[model samples]
Target: MTTSTQPQAQAKRDEHTQPQAQLAVFDMAGTTIDERDEVYRVLRESAEREGARFSDEEFQKWMGTEKHWAIRNLLTIGGVEATDELVDKAFAWFRDELARTYTANPPSPMPRIEESFAALRAAGIRVGLTTGFSRDIADLILESMGWTVGGGEECTIDVSVCGDEIPSGRPAPDMINKVMEITGVDDPAAVISVGDTEVDVESAQAAGAFSVGVLTGHLTKEAFAAKNADAVLELAADVVNLPQVAAQ
Candidate 1:
């Protein structure tokens, strides 16, 4: 099932004070790399291959979450048993198909994302990337985009936390916490988590960080607002224009 903690978390964030952003953690896939939703398309195909079927709404609810978990949930929704063996088989299929699709039509960086990253770093704010993909797939996408991960001067991102590296994925605070730990950012209030889904907003709130939803992916502005995101932007690259990010 799709998990969320929007109601209680939104109220908590409202009462809490937000500090100026020092570390910006971003989600990959639709938020950073414009992969054209191939991941979701492959996910559906894999599920159907296993005799399971679901609607677009069901598919969307799993967006921004770990692929394995998403597959298991989607299988259950389609009246499948969701056995570990079945889930693993489907997951393997998803990985191979997505990789093949990406190879066929390489993904590109979101518009002006490089400039946005540079601007944030120039303002003394560190940048990070968090993703629901495993390390191998995440590395592939990053390599294709010509981005390097590390704290060195030549690196494009300060840190990268993948789904496999964390204990849990979105709506859980683990990945964001990992980013904070790696970036040496102590206060969650000083971190901004940006992505293109409601789970992204829920995850940020769960981590006590500011959440900025972007329309660069699938969700609409109204959908983001309903999730109680701290702010919403027209594009991922437009994050640099946010008052909190700009002030940093």
Candidate 2:
């Protein structure tokens, strides 16, 4: 009788020791893929082409946000009317330029990113990608990287949620929540969100999930610290080594 009770108690202890995070949602572009900042460059070029002029400092604030919103805000900041028609034109130009740029030189995964995904999945944590890119652009990038989204064994990511699919993008937690819903993760605390911008941290925090900021993108460690990120990693690939992940 004591042996039976001891086994059951040990099982309970093991359950308690397991990681609470069931899913890890990574940001695209600067977070998981090294896109060489072409997105922002094209955005600036498009806005300028549309007769909107803004300084780099002014443009920097819009990074890591939905492209359409960024274009609208940049146009407004540059004293343009930012009418829907104007914004649409600028967004179209930006998208075309980005697609051409990517086609010319496709983006690649950040260092050890694939290995990190495998490690996280092996630990029984589902891996997902949530991005501010529109669904078509995100699909283009993923196709270029030979990544497929699904739960199949060969699928590179367990799920993916794009900006266009959500009502709002980062800093709003819509993308993160979409990923959680897709992955069937009901508890926000059982998720981990990682990205390279302030909005990423803000979104995760808003969703009540663990947020990790990576330095591979636009933000510095200090910037992430100011945002109160749960952890700051030099690279997205280093996520597998976080205590919360490694212990799993």
- Give the number of the best model, judged by TM-score: 1
lDDT at 147, model 1: 98
lDDT, model 1: 0.84
lDDT of 2 by residue, 1-248 (tens): 00010101001012223356788999998999999999878989888887888887789878888899989999999989999999999999888889989989999999999988988887888999988788889999999999888887778889998878877776787877777877788887678889998778877777767888899887888888777787888998998876667777
Candidate 2: which pairs clash? none
Model 1 residue 34 lDDT? Answer: 93
Give one digit per residue, the lDDT tens place, for model 1 in 1-248.
12232313664243134667799999998898899989888888878888888888888898998888888999999879999999999999999889888888989998999989888888889999999898889988988888998777677989999888877888787888888888889888888899998788888888878889999888888898788888888887888877777665
Provide TM-scores for the models. 0.93, 0.91
Segments in model 1 whose C-alpha atoms lie over 4 Å from true places: 1-8, 12-17
